[model samples]
Target: MKPMRSIILVVLLTLGLFMLSSCTRTDAPSESHSIAPSQSTDNTNDTPSATARISFVSAGNEAGFYSVEEYDGHGIVAYIDYATQTQLPLCGRPECRHSDSSCTAYALVENMSIPVLAVINDKLVIMQTEVGSDTLPHISIADLDGSNPQLLCELDSNISISPQLYTDGANLYALATVYSGSGSHLELYRFSLKDGSYESLCSFADGVNGMITSCFDMSLTLMFTRIDEESGSVEDYAQVFHVDTNTLDDPVISLTGVSEEAYTIYNSTLITLDTKDALTATMTFTDLRTGSSVEYKTNALLSASGMNSATLNVFDLWDGWYRITLNGDGKFASFNVNPVTGEFFPMTLYYEDSMNVVLIFAESGNNLLVRAGWDETRDGTTLTNLKPIYALISKDDYLHSVPNYTYIEGLDL
Candidate 1:
């Protein structure tokens, strides 16, 4: 199957909609120099309180099922049995086919709004925006078993939340496009799940609606792309913004990089790999907490094959880990990487291969969920995948290169 992010971006940018996009794909290396925040005059020695990284899980809860979205807008509840390598709809009602609005396995899809799945504080949360029939977009809460859905709240019809959501279990952080008589602005919205009070934390680039390059508890790094509505062409903005997630005040730093795809922010540090070529490049690591930046020369740590392919990308992972994915034409390779001192290795554990587009879907507890897409037949251009199956391998096994994994079979019927 094709990369999920690419497909979404193509559709949004294609229609010239100033909607929020997600890196929800790229990664970084290490650097040194005089780095700075835009609004702050603080020197390199000034360091704010260091916050721990936030753990983000997929819509798939710990209860063994994933709520996957279909093209028709409803989210299909797939109950997966890892040991048996099988999956089926989670609807428990007898004699019920997993289709139509009445099916319990299908999430709420009213007025042409797609249901987005998220597990917040052990409660299955489904957020939907009714863009067609009504302006009221509501969030619904369900049990871990995918039953007893109750109305949580209806959002402002004008503000649309992006699918990329980050939560600390108590507070949820979302990027939404706020529409008004003026135009649309991408604002980061923070919601208090307890009392249901919400506030707009910060607004990103004025017309800038793009992707989350990296996300943390106290900070979120974002990259916006300039898309021409007339031509439908997308260009990556030169500056990437790292926004503060703590306060309502506007405090952001812009890191000018060679390519947005090569940037990654973690542990209050920003990394950029300026590639001279597939084999040669320069890496920079900037500690935003200190305002100090460093640069170093580097080269590709993997094999020579497919090094020149244009599908190269870097993505920040849980903790200090980073992922380097190189996919193009018929070649695909993923690696566990570190730009400091050039330590890198291929992702040989899980479903690592050149035959299919293997993806790290999300993190679940102590294990990382991995999957590849499939279809009865693929459209040559879009490469759409019909069935999605996933499995889990211990995070320790993944980072350590141990090949133990449990697979789930995606039912064709």
Candidate 2:
């Protein structure tokens, strides 16, 4: 856990470590997955816990969810109490303090092994390994609360499960990365838990790098970017790849098609910016959930409005937002785009001749996770680097242009 600090992002971002497979459950989308990111509606009454308050609170599922607690260079996992909303170690041993490796909660962390916390469907599935425990990482079966654990199956590689996982009922989509001189991509090893024997299928994805949202059944919405082999420049904007997650049935890989450096698949719609004409552009998005054909009328609308180009940047937020950069006098002017209503929101980072530029990390519930960075300068010399802090704010507050931020203390990792 100390040297293997690279996986801290995966551990903390669980929001809660339950990647529920899209099984025969009739739950809403909110209750179907685990994730984290957000900003300043931080409750002032939040009593300080010994562990870090997970930036993204996972309140979707009520059966209790798992997350990480990285304290004093030591990484440990904990489960949030459903009633009291307090963080507690996974160890259930009577009279046993959880400070040492003897506790089940700290054993894996103390051994310095990579542990992936996930609950595939209704059962708790923890892929972990201890120093003297086993040679290879094994998937274990345990109760929903992770009691009386038994071996499930040994993973061929070391246990390094990504916080984000996708599944379709019987299969657990594990994460992997493709490396080359060109770039890396987000890869998935679809391991089956119940479709007969132990088998895996690599979900096909074509991109230099990618981030998957969820495996809504057999489909995944990926925000990826491809490197330009000719120009050698990474594309200016992100591209969306919505493809079949399981290629077991059909050997042929089915790609919905890549957009012009900019695309987004949100809600049930998959939209790509059509930039064939330099004078104007059009965006026609199809609802993959319904599989309906979308016609072209947005291009005509852009042409009628006399716009310059179709190149845009899509921000994969809670819903969807885009930004269009226009050539300004000295700096590039970026404006946020509203796809549905075709409205634009200018992004001016300064007011009253002062500035406080902020970075948005994630959106959780009605809150946003943002960090404001600024430097103090006096007597012609810069005083410090970017002094910033993680905070939470209501999405409604941000939408209404309120700048009040509730700074959280322990979100720096």
Best by TM-score: 1
Model 2 lDDT per residue over 251-319, tens place: 111223333323444434555555533235455656655666453333433333345443333333344
lDDT comparing candidate 1 with the true structure: 0.51
Quantify all predictions' global Cα lDDT against the true fold. Answer: 0.51, 0.42
Q: Write the per-residue lDDT of candidate 1 for residues 1-413, one digit (tens) a residue.
A: 11222221122110001111110001100011111111111122212324423333345443343445453334465545433445666555555555776765664433435566655555566666445465476666766556677876678778787765655455556678888897888877766655556777667655566644344445555555555567765544323233343543232333332333344444455665565233454556677557777664434643534445434455555555565565555666667666664566677553333343244555546865665434434687675555555667777777666767676655445
Candidate 2 local accuracy as lDDT? 0.42
Regions more than 4 Å wrong, model 2: 1-65, 79-99, 108-114, 119-124, 128-137, 141-146, 158-163, 175-188, 192-197, 202-214, 221-268, 274-284, 289-312, 319-337, 343-393, 398-413
Residue 47 error for model 1, in Å?
25
Counted clashes in each candidate structure = 15, 11
